[model samples]
Target: MGSSRQCFQRFLEQKNIVTNLLGKLEENTGVYYLPTGSIAFLAFCLIFGYGASLLCNLIGFIYPAYASIKAIESPNKDDDTIWLTYWVVYSIFGLAEFFSDIFLFWFPFYYAGKCAFLLWCMLPVACNGSQILYHCPIHPIFLRQQASMDSLVTDLSGQALDTAASLTREATKAGMTHLQKNK
Candidate 1:
């Protein structure tokens, strides 16, 4: 009976220590607004309520659709180029997310996890994953391929110009010759 009482007291002390440690960590981490345990549950319910979910869905669908239409209609070359690069990266990320969802969707916090990841991607702060991806992988690979395609296009255009010039000269000579003979 004495040993049992000692063990229970030790357990309570350990629980208090852990709770205090977590509270300190949260305070230091600057996430004062972030809820934990029961508060977290309530916050989740409020944030992901039906109306909020519907609004998120609507924005998700509308933004991309609107962007696509605007991209098609816009005449600015530089903006179009920027949008093209963004869409390329976005498409690649979307494909990766599609495959990952097969497993991750089963998790209870999947939507929250996804929202956090996307926020990380969009945030302009240092060490953002999207910025890293754009600079390290997508930018380099896309630029190399684009450079090669640009060179190929330039060569083709040069060849076509030469051919057209040659044809025009030949036609002019033939016309002059015909006129001389008629005279």
Candidate 2:
């Protein structure tokens, strides 16, 4: 905890991040975007995303949207490998849930596996739920990339870190006299 806080303080002092653009809204307005209300859960809800992930799985039940992926041939295959991979991973996750339902029948073995799978499937959504709230106009299904909390923090905080790094480095170096001595 101390180290993490120290790092954050370093982040602040070094200004490796600029503004807290976390809540700042971009000016783009379009159908692809979700409102801010949904993203805020990112600041708090890791469990909620599991429910969202379950919903994500439901999206599979839909006749797979024949999304015309860019740089890929059209009508190449309605059921592309990418979609197949998604289905496979999610199915394993769903199977975990299914097994869990019958877990009571098997006690520790089924329950343990079920719990593990349930967590595996749901944790990403709950932790990274913020990404769901922000729809880039280009992502295939908005929040469909199976992003996790680390990825979300990177997406959310990476920009700030970049901005802060530049600003902080320049600020710290502004008073450097070694270069002046050489001159």
Candidate 3:
């Protein structure tokens, strides 16, 4: 708890883009101060029964996608690698979630927990979840399965091409038959 608070404080202290944007909005809105309405809205989303899933999904998708585009545009390869790692981790999580969401959504605070997790995974810190996950279990597992995965993918691609060719031939034959009958 203490470390998390410290990390959040440090994040705020940095006055990064998110904070600066929020601060600017608060200044212009003039309804509430920094973090107050933000915290309230967050808490409301977590506790309320509405829009939580949308919020969580948006958080998981939008920022990382924007960052990925930025990474692609920039000259540095480091951010590119980082964004790629993030996408890898996110894809894995999405696959796991697909099977588990039926049960997972039963929990009251599931969306909130997921939002926090996505934030953790998206954090710019060295110890972020995406980096840790990509380095450890994910990398090891991929290394072990890469050969089999490659073989499977190659087989599937060949089969797909074969099926596509067969379909095209059948369609052309039908078209020729129809044209002859029409004449």
* TM-scores for every predicted model: 0.37, 0.26, 0.88
Which candidate leads the pack in TM-score? 3
Reference-based lDDT, residue 32, model 2: 27
- Residue-pair clashes per candidate: 0, 8, 0
Name the regions of candidate 1 deviating beyond 4 angstroms: 1-58, 116-132, 141-183
After superposition on all CA atoms, how large is the RMSD of candidate 2? Answer: 25.4
lDDT string, candidate 3, 37-74, tens digits: 68678768876858898888888898899889989999
Residue ranges of candidate 2 with Cα displaced over 4 Å: 1-34, 41-73, 101-183
Lowest-lDDT window of 10 residues in candidate 1?
A: 52-61
Candidate 3: pairs in clash: none
Question: Candidate 1 on 59-87: residue-level lDDT in tens?
Answer: 33454455556767988675455445445
Off by over 4 Å in 3: 1-17
Residue 133: error of model 3 in Å? 1.1
lDDT of candidate 2 over 1-183, digit per residue (tens): 999567545543442112123213333433223333443453223233434434434334432332214214556663354444434555654575677655543343333333334334322233322222222322455356547756987887989999999998887787576677778
Residue pairs of candidate 1 with colliding backbone atoms = none
lDDT of 1 at 15: 41
